[model samples]
Target: MKFEIIQPGSYAMIKATLTQGEAIKAESGAMVAMHPNLDVEGKVDGGMFGALKRAVLTGESLFFQTLKANRGAGEVFIAPAVPGDVTILELNGANHFFLQKQSFLASDDAIAIEAVSQGFFKGLLSGEGMFIQKATGKGSLAISSFGSIYKISLAPGQQYIVDNSHLVAWAGTVTYDVQKASSGWFSSVTSGEGLVCKVNGPGDVWFQSRNPGAFGSWIRQFIPSKG
Candidate 1:
């Protein structure tokens, strides 16, 4: 299968192309525009404001959207994200085809994972887990990041401990566990590996440029909170 990313690091539309019989997994609802002939489906749980929240928060231009094609090809996926902040992911096989970066959040009114997962049948299983959207065989995807992306790959018999503050994304097949750092929080905090997210086996891992909670602290210092 062949894939390409047309635009890098822009809030504007990003495009990709894919070949048949290939697969890509991502967070759903990243499409801003595409071919009219393509078959599409958007899945999300049936609940009060569940679908609406995804449309508003996840940075998806639309609520729980998808596209499919049996014989048609050469489709385009656009990022309809707001001008300042965008969240989208485009993948082809195990590689990232495209990504857009947006600024950090200024408030705690974050989007819920379960609402975003509604775009796919999987719906968010955990209140704190990440959301996923995937494509099987021949398609391009677009994603957004708050800053530049980082990568880590794990080998067989090896394990990785990543701070949730730095984690961006990882391969679908890999397993993740929240564990105590080998050298303790002090070591990790000082060494940039604090209280880790342990990952195993041949797959990629991503890390964010900054932490929201950490950022929040910085924001709070300027303005005291009420008890």
Candidate 2:
């Protein structure tokens, strides 16, 4: 299977070419176009218990759509739910990363997506909820973000501060500490910088330029809401 990331930011698409019998598991409603020869089916990823874990903990829907090239070679197109950039990650031995909520787009069958708890403070104050998606096994995976994504590399004992809302994914080799952005609580609220994450990295961290939560809050003033 071969894949191309069409467009880089704002709006991106994943265009994949699959040889016979190649299959890709994708998020529901993400498929934009596909070849007729490919067979499409909806699946509850993992089993019943595993599906429950993903849905309840990770904020991801239990269902996923599978596209299988049953006939000859075929093409498939998939896009994210929002306007953003798309990133393709090749998974091999020792591949494991902390996936941001709702960021997973697609992957090969060999990959496993699970909801793993990240403990109390990270669960409560990290902007991301309790359980983040943990991707493992061997396969290719695609992730999406609401804005341009940047990769920050870290050496042992080095530290980086990231706004909680801007974090997308990170390598598991790193350690993270969450705290208020400012030492003074009054300054924290007034400065428009809230909680931030102190990532003690020996690995990489992927962050987004835009904060969707803050964007929605800013635009909601003009949009009508239920009383």
Candidate 3:
């Protein structure tokens, strides 16, 4: 199978080309279009129990859409629910990724996506909740962002501070601590950056240019309130 990110940057989508009998699994409702030769089916990956775990833990869709080139080779277009950028991560057997809620778009059938615990304190303080989606195995995994996605590569022992809200995904090898953005709570709040993740990395980190929470807050003011 071959994957290409179409219309990169804001308003991005994925165009996947599959060989005969090849299949791709995507978040439910992500398929925008497909060739006539392609067949689509809804499936609960890893069964009902796995689906439940993914939905209840990470807020992902309970079902996945599997598109196959059953009839022959074909192309399928998959898109995210929001208008933003889309990119593909190539996961070898040795590497994995932890994706933010709803960042997953599509992946080759060889990849496995699971909901994993991030520990109690990190879960609560990291702003990604108790569980995040982990992608493993060998395949191409497509991830979406609320805005443009930028990648930061860190050398071993290098550290960087990132606002929690801007994170899209990070390499599993990276370690981070969630803490106040400033030395003091009052200064942190006043600085407009409350909690930030101090990332110690030997890997890459992907961040979205826009924060969904901040965007929501900005739009809320324009919405007429109930009198």
Best by TM-score: 3
State candidate 3's TM-score: 0.97
C-alpha root-mean-square deviation, candidate 1: 9.4
Candidate 3 local Cα displacement, residue 92, angstroms: 1.0
RMSD of each: 9.4, 1.4, 1.0
> How many backbone clashes does every candidate have?
14, 0, 0
Could you arrange the candidates by lDDT from highest to lowest?
A: 3, 2, 1
Candidate 1 has its poorest 10 consecutive residues by lDDT at: 100-109
Give candidate 3's error at residue 103 in angstroms.
0.8
List runs of model 2 lying over 4 Å from the truth. Answer: 225-227
lDDT by residue (tens digit), candidate 3, 28-124: 9999999999999998997899889999998888899999999999999999999899988989999999998779999998798899998999888
Cα lDDT of candidate 1 equals 0.43
lDDT (Cα, tens digit) per residue for candidate 1, span 165-205? 45545555566666556557677567754566566766766
Clash-forming residue pairs, model 3:
none
Candidate 2 lDDT? 0.87
Better of 1 and 2 by TM-score: 2
Which prediction has the highest lDDT against the true structure? 3
